[model samples]
Target: MHFELGFVLLFSIATAVAIAARYFKFPYTVALVVAGLTLGVVHAFEPPHLTKDLLFAILLPGLIFEAAFHVEFRKFWKNKLAIHALAIPGVVAAVGVTALILSPVVGGLDSVRDFGFIHALVFASVIVSTDPIAVVGLFKALGAPKRLAILVEGESLLNDGTAVVLFTLIVAVAGGAHFTVGGATMDFIRVAGVGALIGGGIGFAISQVIQRVDDAMVEITLTVIAAYGSFVVAEHFHYSGVIATVVAGMLCGNWAASTSMSPSTRVAVESFWEYLAFALNSVVFLLIGLEVQLGSLLASWRPILLAYVAVVAGRAVVVYGVSALLRFTPERMPWSWSAVLTWSGLRGAISMVLVLGLPEGFAHRELLVNMTFGVVVLSIIVQGLTMAPLLRRLGVSGLKDVYQEKYELARGRVGAIHAALTALEALRRTRDIPADVVEQLERDYQQKAAAAEQELSALKQQTNRFHEEEHQEGVRRMLIVEKDALLKAYQRGVIGKEAFEHLVAELDERLAKVKDPEGHVPLEQSSPSLPDAA
Candidate 1:
C-alpha cells in the first residue's frame, strides 16, 4: 500500500476500534491490540516495520509526558519509597531472576543455545519493563484506590527508564563492550541523574516563560516543545531520554500547570496532550498487533511459555518481597495489593522497541523477538481481561453502585443549574439579554436547583442504609468535582466570579466536614474529582 493510503487505513481502523471499545466497555489499549492482531492474521495489509527511532524519538515522548504530567505529585511522594523500590530495585531483581531462569532454557534450545547468559540477560531486560497503560486504564474504569493507581503508574514510568538503562548495558556486554559492577553502577546513576537534571532544568525554564505569557496557543505550543525537545536534547547527550521526558512532564503538570499557565492555557495544554497521547497510543498498540509474526511465535512456544512463567515469577518475587520489607513502614501495604501489583505488570511497546533494535546478527535475535511478542500479547489479553474480576475477588473493587451514580448526577444537576443562573445574571446586568428572558431563565434554573437539592437530600438519607464511609467518600468526591467544574466555568466565562466563589466556598466547606482533622482523605477513596478544567 502507498504510504498515504496505509496511514489512512490504520487511522480508520483505530477509529473503529475506539468506538467498539467504548460500546463494549473494553479497555481501549487491549481493543487496539486485538484489532491489529486480527488484521495481521487476516493479512488485510502489512504494517510498515516499526523502527526504534520512530518509537523512542517520535511516539514515546508524548506518551511518557502525558502519563507523568497527570501523576499526583503529592500521592507519588507519599508512596515514594515503595514506588522507587519497585521501579529501581524491583526492575533489577526481575531482570536478574528472569535472565537466571531463562539462561539454561535458552542454552538447551538448538537454534540459539550458543547465545549464553549475556544474551539471555539482554532479552530479560527487554521484557522486564512493565507497561501500565492497560492496567491503569482498568484501574480508572474500575475505580481502584487512588494510592494504588498512583503507585502502579509512578513505578511504571520510572521502571521504563531503568529497564532501558539495563538493556543498554547488557547489550554492550553482548556486543563485547567492557562491563564491571562499579562501572555499571556509575553509568546507571549518570544516565538517570543527568536525564532528570536536564528534564527539570528545561521544564523550569519553560514554566518561567509560560508564567509571563497569557496566550493559550503559545503556551500549548511551548509545552509541546518541552515534551519532545527535552527528550531529544537528553538523548543527544546520551542521557536517558525516557527519564528526562518523564521528569519534564511531571514538572510541567504539577508546577507549570498550576502556577505558570492561565486557566485557559492550562486547559488547552492538557487537552492537547491528552489527544496526542490517545492518538499515539492508538497507533502504537494497533501496530503491535499488525507486526506480530505468529509462525515465528508458534515455533518458539517452548521458550515463550518458559519466559512467560519466569516473568510472572519474577514479578511475584519483587512485589511480595518488597511489600514484606516495607511492612515495618508507617504505611504498610496489604497482601491483596501486592497480588494485584504482581499481576498488573504487563509489558508492551517498550519491550518490542528494544527487541527490534537489537543489532543484526546478534545471537537468537529472531527467537527473542518472537518470545517477547508472545509475552506482550498474553499480558495485554490475559492479564488485562482478568484485572477487574481479580480486583473484585480481592474485595478492592471500586465499582460504584447505581444509587451512587444517581446521587452524583443529582449533584451535577445542582451545579449546572447554579451555573445557568450565574450566566443569566451576567447577561441581564449587561443587557445582552432582555430582563424578561433573564427572569424566566432564573425561575427555571431555581426550580431545577430546588428539585436537584431535594433529590440529593433523599439520596443522602438513603446512604444511611448502605456503607456510610463509602457513601461519604463518594459525596466528598462529588463535591470536589463540582467545585472543579465551577472553577472551570468561571475561567471560561460561563459563570460569574461571585457565583464561582460562592459555589467553591460551599464545596470547600462540605469537603472539610467530610475530611479528617489532618485534611487527609483516605487513599482508598474512589473516583477522584476530574482534572480542574483549565
Candidate 2:
C-alpha cells in the first residue's frame, strides 16, 4: 500500500473502533487491538510497518507526556512509595522470575531450545513493563479511585525507562558486552539520573518560556517541543528517553499548567496532548493487532501459554507481595487495590517494540516475539474486559460514588439559585427595573431557591446514610471543586488575590480535616455556608 493510503486506512480503522468502543462501553484501546486482530486475520490490508524511530521517537513521547501531564501530583506523591516499589523492583522481580521459570522449559521447545537463562532474561525484560494505556483507560471509565489510577499510571510511566534500560543491558550481555553487578548498577543509575535531569531541565526551561508568552498556540507548541525534544536529546546522549519524556511531562502538568500558562492556554495544551495520546494509542494498539503473526503464535502456543502463566504469576507476586510488605507504611495498599493492580499489568507496544528490535539471527527471537504478543493479547482481551466487573465485585466501582455525584448536582442547583437571587437583587437596585418585572424575577428565583433547598436537603439525608469513607470522599471532592473555583475566580479577576488565597487556605484546611479519618468532619456538620463568591 502507498504510505498515505496505509495511514488513512489505519486512521479509519481507529475511528471505527473508537466509535464501536464507545457504543459498546468497551475500553477504546482494547477495541482497537481487537479490530486490528480481526483485520489481520482476514488479511484486509498490510499492517503499516512501524519502524523503531516511528514508534519510540515519534509516537511514544506524546503518549508518555499526556499520561504524566494528567497525573495528580499530590496523589502521585502520596502513593510514590508503592508506585516506585512496584515499578523498579517490581519490574526486576517480574523479569527475574519470568526468566527463572521459563529457562528450564526453553530446552524442551524446538524453536527456543538454544536459548538459555540469559536469553530468557532478555525476553522477560522486554515484556516486564506494564502498558498503562488500556488498563488506565478502563480504570478511568470505571471511575476507579484517583489514587489507584495514579499509582498504576505513575508506576507504568517510570517502569518503562527501567525496563528499557534492563532490556538494553541484557541484550548487550547476550551480544558479548561485558557485564558485572557494579557496572550494571552504575549504568542504570547513570541512564536514569541523566534522563531525569535532562527532562527536568528542559521542562523547567520551557515552562519559564511559556510564562512569558500568553498565546495559546505558542504555549502549546512549546510543550510539543518539550515532549519530543527532551526525549530525542536524552536518547542521543544514551540516556533513558522514556524517563526524560515522563519527567518533562510531569513538570509541564504540575508546574507549567498551574503557574505558567493562562487558563485558556493550559486547557488548549492539555486538549492537544489528550488528542495526541488518543490518536497515537489508536494507531499503536491497532498495529499491535495487525502485526501479529498468527501462525508463529500458534506454532509457539505451548511456550506462549507457559509464558502467560509465568507473567501473571510474576505480577501477582509483585502486587500482593509488595502490598503485604508495605502494610505498615503510610502508603499501605488495600488488598482490593492490589488485586486490580495485579490484573492490570497488561503489556503492549513497548514489549512489541523491544522484541521486534532483536537482531534478525538471534536465537529464539521469533518465539519470544510471538509469546510477548500472546501475553499482550491475553492481558488486553481477558483482563481488560473483566476490569469493570472486578471493580464492581470489589465494591470500588464508580457507581458506588453516585451519592457524591448527586450531592454535587444538588449543591450546584443551590449555588445557581443563590447567584440568580443575588443578581436579581443587584439589578433591581442598580437598574430602572419595573415593579412587575422585579416581582416576576423575584418569584422565579424564590421558587427555584425553594426547590433547590428541598433537593439539597434530600440529598444530604440520603448521603448521610453512606459509609464513612464514602461520605469523606464526597466532602474531599467538594472541597477540591470549591478550591478550583476559587482559583479560577482569582485568575479571571472576579476575586482579589488576597480573598482567593484566604479562601483557598480555608478550603485546604477543611480538606485536610476531611481527609483525616480520625478528626473527620462532614461539610454540613462543620459549615453550612458556602464560601463567599464575592
Best by TM-score: 1
On lDDT, the candidate that comes out on top is: 1
Error of 1 at 471 (Å): 9.9
What's the TM-score of each model vs. the native?
Answer: 0.83, 0.82
The candidate 1 region of ten consecutive residues with least summed lDDT is 517-526
Cα lDDT of candidate 1 equals 0.85
CA-only RMSD, every prediction: 9.1, 8.4
Candidate 2 residue spans exceeding 4 A from truth: 401-404, 412-454, 466-534
Question: Ten consecutive residues with minimal summed lDDT in candidate 2?
Answer: 518-527
lDDT of each: 0.85, 0.83
Candidate 1, residue 337: Cα displacement in angstroms equals: 1.2
Which pairs clash (backbone N, Cα, C closer than 3 Å) in model 1?
Answer: none
